[model samples]
Target: MLTSLEFRLLATAKAAPELRHRLRDHGHDVRLCATELLTNVIDHLGEGTPVTVRVIGTAAEHGRVRVEVTDPAPDSPPVLRSAAGWEESGRGLALVDALAERWGVDVGPDRKTVWCELVGDGRADGRPVSGAARPTAPARGR
Candidate 1:
């Protein structure tokens, strides 16, 4: 299944439950990752910027559900950085990293997509695939 939407901060709050329903058993992790990615867009690119969010599911054997957030800012890619104990805000991507099987940024001439894949049988309680090495930064893809 594949779902896509024009993103807006207000609309997202209402969209969450619907997104969760559409994602079925993978709802929790996918919704959280989608929220973090959307928040990054709002924080860094401003709320009204053109953004599109997509959710795509693969075959059961693949055990994968991918979420992608595309924004018009090709130059402002997201960064993954360690937040200081006293800081309150630099942790979005870190949370994405923790939950995604692998996440990356795809830069294009007019836009960039920030995406993450969650791998599992959709049966485990919301955790990422076991033993996957956490990446320090999101990989760059075409």
Candidate 2:
């Protein structure tokens, strides 16, 4: 079974308590990205939303996790808002755009899903995906 985005957030939080730690160590800023994405889907996209999460790669903790938050609002897919500063609202997708590795929408007649994928660094055996995410050693003698 695959883990939900909420559960993934919790697991990442447990694995690395600090936000920077989660981002740098994991090679994917999934926590903040997921938060913004889900919030956008819930607040603006539609009500009674259903989000689907998928993890694909070599293994559980070493793969690309794509999160798709589906909503009933089909006509309004996510769009980038180019608003001036000091605006009353907006900017979720903008932040998502800046943060996510890749993000887009899957549109349908009666539904739409805004999806984002965060590729893991794949550090189960001490080697990172691109030599950028070196795994931190476990704390000893608890």
TM-score for all models, in order of appearance: 0.71, 0.54
The local lDDT score (0 to 100) that residue 126 gets in candidate 1 is 50
Supply the global lDDT for candidate 1. Answer: 0.67
Q: In model 1, which regions exceed 4 Å deviation?
A: 1-25, 121-142
Per-residue lDDT of 25-101 in model 2, one digit per residue for the tens? 33345555655666665566444355543222222564554545555678877778876798865787888777656
Each model's lDDT: 0.67, 0.50
Q: Model 1: per-residue lDDT, tens digit, 1-142?
A: 3222333333244454554554455567777888788778778977566677766554244677667888888999899999999998999999989988888998899989899887753423553322222222244532
* Candidate 1 least-lDDT 10 residues: 128-137
RMSD of 1: 7.5
The best candidate by lDDT is 1
Clashes of 2: 0
